[model samples]
Target: MARMFRVLGFFTLVIALMSFAGDLTEMSLLFFVQTVVFFLLGYLNFTEKTYILLFWAYMVLSFLGFTYWTVFRMGLPF
Candidate 1:
């Protein structure tokens, strides 16, 4: 179980890093990954607040990464 969890963590990290480098084509994939992170954290036996905190932190990081990718790749800002 521990080994499986470690492997999954490694996989997620890779995905997250790729997500930082993706364009709009991968936005949905990034969202899916964010959803999975929430799902896994939600299943924890800890407090609900912990889940909320982790989710928000993850969102902040994801938003910054995606925003950076979009702004640089799309060059859409006026």
Candidate 2:
């Protein structure tokens, strides 16, 4: 169960990144949804301490990427 959650979280992160890289214009919805899912999965699987650090790093990077894409690429008012 825990391993499955970890795998899902990892894949979510990858999908989020790929979505961002593929189409910044169309990624807003997908990225947002994936991020929310990643957060929920991470929270629910908090018992896995080994991957916690990596997860946090991925979260931070994803957030920064999303912000950058939205504010700079999409030209949305920050």
Candidate 3:
């Protein structure tokens, strides 16, 4: 599980770099924060089930945030 978190942190760091290169500062910052969080979590000694639950919570929150941003923040006609 810790290894998985570190992998995710690496992936997010890549994403953050890409976003920065693309001039998406806000997105870059968001991913940068996530990278830090994942790295921190990776160093912690947590149980596998806890890690799984945390990942699930992250997924749910991210999906909901993305949906909200696309639907409401984007201002597209319904």
Please report the candidate that would top TM-score against the real structure: 3
Candidate structures ordered by lDDT, highest first: 3, 2, 1
Q: Which ranges in model 3 have alpha carbons more than 4 Å from their true place?
A: none
Off by over 4 Å in 2: 1-6, 9-47
What is candidate 1's lDDT per residue for 11-77, written digit by digit as tens? 7666666666765446547645754654465445556566557556866987898899889978986
Clashing pairs in 2: none
Looking at candidate 2, the ten consecutive residues that score lowest on lDDT are 1-10
TM-score of 2: 0.43
Could you report the Cα RMSD, in angstroms, for every candidate shown? 8.4, 8.1, 0.9
Q: Rank the candidates by TM-score, best first.
A: 3, 1, 2
Better of 2 and 3 by TM-score: 3
Report every candidate's CA lDDT: 0.61, 0.67, 0.98
TM-score of each: 0.48, 0.43, 0.95
Question: What lDDT tens digits, residue by residue, belong to model 2 across residues 15-56?
Answer: 778777778646646655765666676566556664666667
Q: CA shift at 74, candidate 2, in angstroms?
A: 0.4
Better of 2 and 3 by lDDT: 3
